[model samples]
Target: MLDASGYTVISGPVGSYLAERLAAAIASRNRWNGCVWLRRPQRNLRSLDAALAEACAKRWRADTHPTDDPRRRLERALLGSPEGAVVVVEVTDLTTAIGRLMTGLRPLASDRGVRLVVVAEGLRLPVVRFAPDALVAPAALGGVDGLAARVGLLASAPVAARRLTRLAERRPAVATDLLDAAAVWPHDVLLGALAGRTRTLERVTAALLDLCTPAQRSALETCATTGYWHPQLDTGVVRAADLRPWLVPLEESWSWVRPIWLAPLRRALARRGPSPVVARPAAAGPGSPDDRRLRPPDDRRSRSTGDQGSRSSEDQGSRWTGRGVVEVRLFGGFEVRVDGVVVDFPGRRGRSVLRFLLTRPDRRCPRDQLLEEFWPDVDGRAARNRLQVAVSGLRSALRSATNDHVIEYASGEYRIAPAVRVRTDVEEFEEALGAARSAGRPDVALSAYHQAIDLYRGDFAADVPYESWTLLPRESLRLRYLDALDAAGRIALRTGRIDDCVVTAHRVLEVDPCREDAHRLLMRCYARQGRPHQARRQYELCRRLLAATLSVEPAPETTALYRSIRPR
Candidate 1:
């Protein structure tokens, strides 16, 4: 067995926070006998060392070779022990440092004796000298999204982490001293007090005022006053060519002042009144998606065609609005309606592939997962080709109903995007049932469970009941429905709605007649109403179901429940 390979290179945006986090992970690895961190002797490097100590819980001694030549000293450091060791080197300037170090480190890096890791900023690492196999690159942190993530990485508190994300999402690309303050404490820095005039705050305020024209400053003040900035809504700003430079667009209609300076700008503006937005000489930056875009896929779903009932029918008006409101009914049967028109999945493979994606529509499903599930016997190349053809077929099948939003491929994976409001009955049912479980009030749970049962028109993939692949999913849906019905009945009984309890219990029996719990529930409901005959009848039905379906008599609990309820 192989012990190790050439050193790995983890490349990302340059920050002590990221490097420290990586060091912590490397230190935790069991195989490494030793670890060393190399960097230039400077104030920022010292800060990194301090962060490393807190992050990985081990202080690394600064062992910069004081030898006559730095090259020899750096070479000796690179060539750690012949055995196993992990080496992390920080680079401020990638071009000059990387090639020179790699030239000196060629033997050690290639020997595989020690694992070499290079940590540097994205800007510094223009071109890497290390082998392509060794690079582990994560995307550069961008704007509020990136900042929010950075806050979470450094903060331990859950509430603080959430606040950090909220702040970053809401104020994209709007850098401020207060925003930078989040990384300072890492744990709810927003909750901290601002006492005397801070230099960083003043500097940030000055920078914003300098960046914007007099009119733009006034427009910002008006925005701060209103608590929202609509560039189009402001007539003067709309006509100005410098609006882009004055404020970067965060969403369709909304824009925020560059580099934030919100608190400072607000205070500055209150001194006078609203100002016009004048043209700035500098070019505008690219627009970013609104914070609303960060909403979950399920949340992104349009509520226009809100809730659909189980076995409930509605005449959804037939209109092929390119909006692609795809309604998938999987329980009881399979039906995919585009807008309001029924679309046929003319092939088994297409239907199966679609079903898997529908179950987990929020993310992309890789080709391998789909191939292994459906085409287990086929080789990789053939399976991939088949998948491509199948995807095309699906698009054609759903062209009228779903149009462009049906099945999309990207990076060798496929997904059903939420661009088309997708409402699958099974998902809706499970969602309702989940809501019931979390619901505090019995009535809430009762309503949820009832709706879940109603939405389940038939078994999941009931159209392909005998198909081998369909068995597990079909059985799963059936069992969950029975469980939901059982909970609904129990809630009904607890709420003194005995008639509703009896009805729910009967629904459970229709799904799984041999379920003794449903039988006992029905008997209890009848007995509570003083219908001894009905209770006795429920006991006989349970006995017959047990004998016929499972060849077993009632359990001790069932017999005792019958005795308690029947003519007693």
Candidate 2:
């Protein structure tokens, strides 16, 4: 139900069967006043603005303001439309571009009489927080009364259909897969697959598990063994959205793994018996933590407080003794390991404290600053207590795998132990970039640049992009990465590596669609390949992105390049 805001957000997996059915229902109801459906296909490279323009073409037939952007154009068109006119937007993914677009449209849509329906995958916090009314449509695939009819099993074997539905964990996607298998195989073969007598079910289950991080898998395994998750477990590290169409929420903090997955998890656990190997962390997107052994620190100098830099007890020749460095990965995801084993923190807050301290150039931070940064919403005394608890928890977690003196407190300041050797991806990334810049030879510089680029798995601490302290640093690292890519592209172009130039240029556009220079780079690459038509298409995409999103034309340089490449 929508409140005074006239904004309704449907939360679920974007392409799921239930979400699509609900969207169709909404469109059917709003057909009287006119419903504009805006959707982008998976393979479509067109921007969201292009989708919107196409959807509202009939409504926007009348002249719009000359200076209006996509938002304003839609607003003008909506304001003049009949009452109850609704715009149903199908969001493919929640990128930065979509976030900005939604924020601007929310208020304008609220003030107007028309209703705005946003069908988005995962939970969009901004949409939920800003909207006066929001609804999360359930994704459960319960009830088997009409299930057999839908899958063509009711007349032939109703009982088997009900049993199959239950075995599929009542998940529409899983049930559909089972039905597809049934169609291809004989009854005995299908039964064998379901019973795990064949490898078919195992293969399918393994594919789904592959998407999860080590932590998520561990959590799921625990849930499979026990009925519920431990209350103190940091489930925030498990992105529910990422587990979608398979894992569903049983309650606010607990998740219900589909029945299809339960037997496989239990069997795998039984096979391992004791000391099961923890899978390394997968290379996930922002806020994703993956496990991999990090390279040791290049420098062996101890971080001592005094000018003389006396080595502390813990640092006394540990590097030579062959104890591995405490590898802290802050880029892409937040992960720490000692001797190649992943360290598990007590909670997300403890991990956050560790990340905050690592970002400090001096490796020390004032106690007051930490409390203010991490626990600002709480009262002073409570916030201070929380900070201490977080720090203590962080220290304990690290101590389990390394020296007890990994963290130290002195004179109202908290810092990493001066004696401990640490290596971080962020440092490695910067060092490689520095090496690239200082290299005298083009080949040397190009190699350094590629090394730096590879180190940047994703944005810094990408898993927690919205945190207050990470905002500036995240943007800073992203710009540096873009610059490195630009440099690499230019060098590759000069060296006659047309393919490398094209690849780097495409990577830049993926991160920031409005990167006009990257578009020009692609234009040049395509023209070099003697593909003027493709070059013109690139220019048109650039112009449309600028006009629709920024309400501006491409720069003069871009136009001139396009003119030269045009089939004149």
Model 1, position 48: C-alpha lDDT score: 41
Q: By TM-score, how accurate is candidate 2?
A: 0.50
lDDT digits (tens) for residues 29-69 of candidate 2: 33433667776323233356545644565654645664766
What's the TM-score of every candidate structure?
Answer: 0.42, 0.50
List RMSD in Å for every model shown: 29.7, 16.9
Candidate 1 lDDT, 172-257, residue by residue in tens: 22332344444433222233222223343444444444555555554454444333355332323332234332343445455444
Q: How many steric clashes does model 1 contain?
A: 7
Model 2 alpha-carbon drift over 4 Å, by segment: 1-321
User: Top lDDT: which candidate number?
Assistant: 2
Worst 10 residues of 1 by lDDT: 289-298
